[model samples]
Target: MHRRDFLTFSGLGVAGLMLPHARLVAAEELLAPADVARQKLLADTVLAAAHKAGASYCDVRIGRYLNQAIVTREDRVENVVNSESAGVGIRVIVNGAWGFAAAHRTTPEGLATAVGNAVAIARANSKIQSRPVQLAPQKGVGEVSWRTPLKRNAMAVPVKDKVELLLSVNAAAINAGADFINSQLFLVNEQKYFASSDGSWIDQDVHRIWLPFTATAIDKASGKFRTRAGLSAPMGMGYEFLDADPSGRYELPGGVVGYGRSYDPVADAIAAAKQAREKIKAPSVKPGKYDLVLDPSNLFLTIHENVGHPLELDRVLGYEANYAGTSFATLDKRESGFRWGSDIVNFFADKTQPGSLGAVGYDDEGVKTKQWDLVRDGILVNYMATRDEVHLLGEDASHGCSYADSWSSVQFQRMANVSLAPGRAPLTPHEMVKDVENGIYILGRGSYSIDQQRYNAQFGGQLYYQIKDGKIAGMVEDAAYQIRTPEFWNACSAICDERDFRLGGSFFDGKGQPSQVSAVSHGAATTRFNGINIINTARSLG
Candidate 1:
């Protein structure tokens, strides 16, 4: 078979094998408006039943998802997928203990059974509890629904067009002499309808997209291998996101049109090839304390590990100790004027930022989302909290951090769009690098490790360049940095302007008891730090 034909057939083959049963499962009749109203009625019925059964509190979550993915490797289309899911979860507080149950079926009978099972579980668990669960006080909320703005629905796009785009990207890489190229694109559109006994009703529509690419090259002479990986940040966007130049203005996109220029993926491929070649030949780095300049891609991960996870009140209170370790930064310290960074540093956790991966109109707990501080002027200020943990932190109400990655999972406090506040004055990344007389400029995230307490941590990066006499010398290898959390932030000397900031994130950040994967974004500007411990990975191996 021709390469292109084989690629097309491969995708079809996989679809043929897996889709028939999946389609059957997803073919439930769409809920009519009256049916939706009845579902709400059923939810109220279940909540009332639980309360009458001696339950303290109860809530229900109904979720539906439409997911599609396409992948291509060099000349071969490796995978094509389309799937749908719908489910409901019932949660209850019985005698101060929590219990939960979920069912894929959305019938009134199914929901009633799930709620009954939850109450039973909670009653059983209450026997071993020490104190009655006390949720922070909150006023009753009324019905509301929100949908993110989209120029075109992702599902409306033809599958063939998406496949063609993937193939084109793969071909571009192959033309640059990449021995192997792999690319994957995923789109998910989720709809959730939530109802609570407090008169709160919420409907939310959220869309997400992910694009990841990997390329590998081999040297026949030395038998050495090198690879490059690039993963795009997931955005709350739609099919318009896939358009190269939706406005027809820019040679690339957004702007820069009318300027004598051309849009070509080959240019990107050439740059990647050159970078891969240089990285393989770069020399190992020397270990010592040195000033450092961090690009946004590298610094964002630092923020996620240090500021994001540590500031979660649940993690600080040891609620997450069984799985992910708890934070040394506690609630008391957060408000006690603890210094978290240099005087210029400030950070906020926001769920309303435009295009942010974590942006949500309402949390899984049915609470309206809002923005708040995690750090201000170097002082540790706030911890991400939900309604249940708000009282522990002496807060009035939740900051709306609750989240559940799947319909079956229980809602847990999750990270928000944690972001560093940009410098008041404009400072470009180039200027920051120029200010560093002798330092290393780190770009892209790499291997990372942090202690159980989240105090000491080490990070490596995809690319590192040595700086000397206020100029980037060349690419360097075997470079890594280690520092205590407080010490690391204290050393922050400057942060670049807002224009220098970029969003970076991971699709599979793991947390919770049953283990759930959540996608979160961290926005950061290029930053500089002083006197950090650097290591030579090549020498350390010996």
Candidate 2:
């Protein structure tokens, strides 16, 4: 098989996992106004049945999920697919224990049966319960609807247009000296309706899109190969994200362009081809302790792994240890004033930030989403908590972090849009890098590994630039950094201002026993960490 063909098949396979199931329906059948009304009715029926079946509290989620993927290589379209999945999931508390059930059929009888099954499961589980679940108080916000404010709904866009875009992107990479290129555009639409016993009936129309591609430049003579990935991020926006914005674009210090709300895939592909070609000849780094300057693309994943995952209240309390692993940021660690970062470093977990993957008006459990401080003045101040987890931290409200990933999955504590606050005083990436005598500047996440406790870890990036005499010397390769979580964050360094802030996100962050995927974003300015251990990965391999 051709390399591009193999990549296209692999891309489709991953997209299948992302959407889970692809039950195809006519566009009108799946998206008509009547369908939404029917979903709301199904949710109402489930809630009513749960209450009648001796349940104290109940909520139902009726969802219609749509996904489209277009894959291309050079000037050829490999695959174009459209799939949909619709179902209703019901949850209830009976005898103080939680139970949940789901059904693909959206009929009134099917929903009622699902709700009854949930109540029965709750009662059975209560027989062996350690204690009744204590849920934090939440006042219901009456009937409401929230839609992602989008200039263009990706679902409404033509597949031909999407295919043309990917083909152009591939051509750009190949024209810029790429030996091989594979590009794909994935679009998702989640039409959800929620109704609960707490007098809340919420409906939401959510949209998300991701454009990812790999550009490889190979040297068959020396047998060396290097690849650069798309700098674009998965966003909770629409097709409009692909629109170019000259005014909003930032000129990065290292001659790279940084995108804000919009992206230019053709330009990024052109740059990726050049970068990958150069990477084949980039010098390998010499291992030593040197200050590290991190671009937002690189720092977002570090923040996700070290800060976002560790601070999930369920992870810290060991509720997720079986699958997702426990956290080192335990209750005692927070109480003892553990410094999670430098005094200048601050972090916030929010679901209210526009354009972030985690942004939603309300979480799955009907709690209104809001922002809160996670790290304050270098201290571990709070953890991401759902309604059930908040009371353990002596909090009276949920952090609105509960999410289910799909209608069939049970809701649980999930990460929010955790972000590092930019420097209060004026600063820029150039200014932050100028003071470093001997250092490395890293961009884009490459590979990473962390212990079960999310404490000790090592990270590598897509591009590394050697800094000598307070200037970017040249590109470097085979560089990775090792650190203990607290020690790593406490290195006390400068951060660029909000003008330099940007978001990077994950489309398939997995958790739980059945392992559902959640999309989340982490935002940060270009930041510095001082005197970190830089290892030569190639040297170690030898």
Question: Among these predicted structures, which one has the highest lDDT?
Answer: 2
TM-scores for every candidate against the unseen true structure: 0.88, 0.96
lDDT of 2 by residue, 1-542 (tens): 12343343455553453344446554434344426666666777777778789999998888777777777777787766667777888889999999999988766677767887898999999999999988898898988999888998777776777788888999899999999998988777788888888888899888888898889999889989999988778899988899877764777767877777899999999999999999999989999999999999888998999999999999999989888789889899888998888999999998988999988899999999999999999999899999988999989999999998788989999999999999898998888878999999998888787899999999988889988888889999999999898899899588899888899988778789897778899999999999999999999889
Off by over 4 Å in 1: 1-42, 245-270
State each model's C-alpha RMSD to the native.
5.8, 2.6
lDDT of 1 by residue, 9-88 (tens): 24454342121113422212212122456556766777787788777788888776666767777877776767666678
Local distance difference test values of all predictions, in order: 0.73, 0.85
Best of the candidates, TM-score? 2
The reply for model 2, stretches above 4 Å from the true place, is: 1-21, 25-36
* Cα error, candidate 2, residue 204 (Å): 0.6
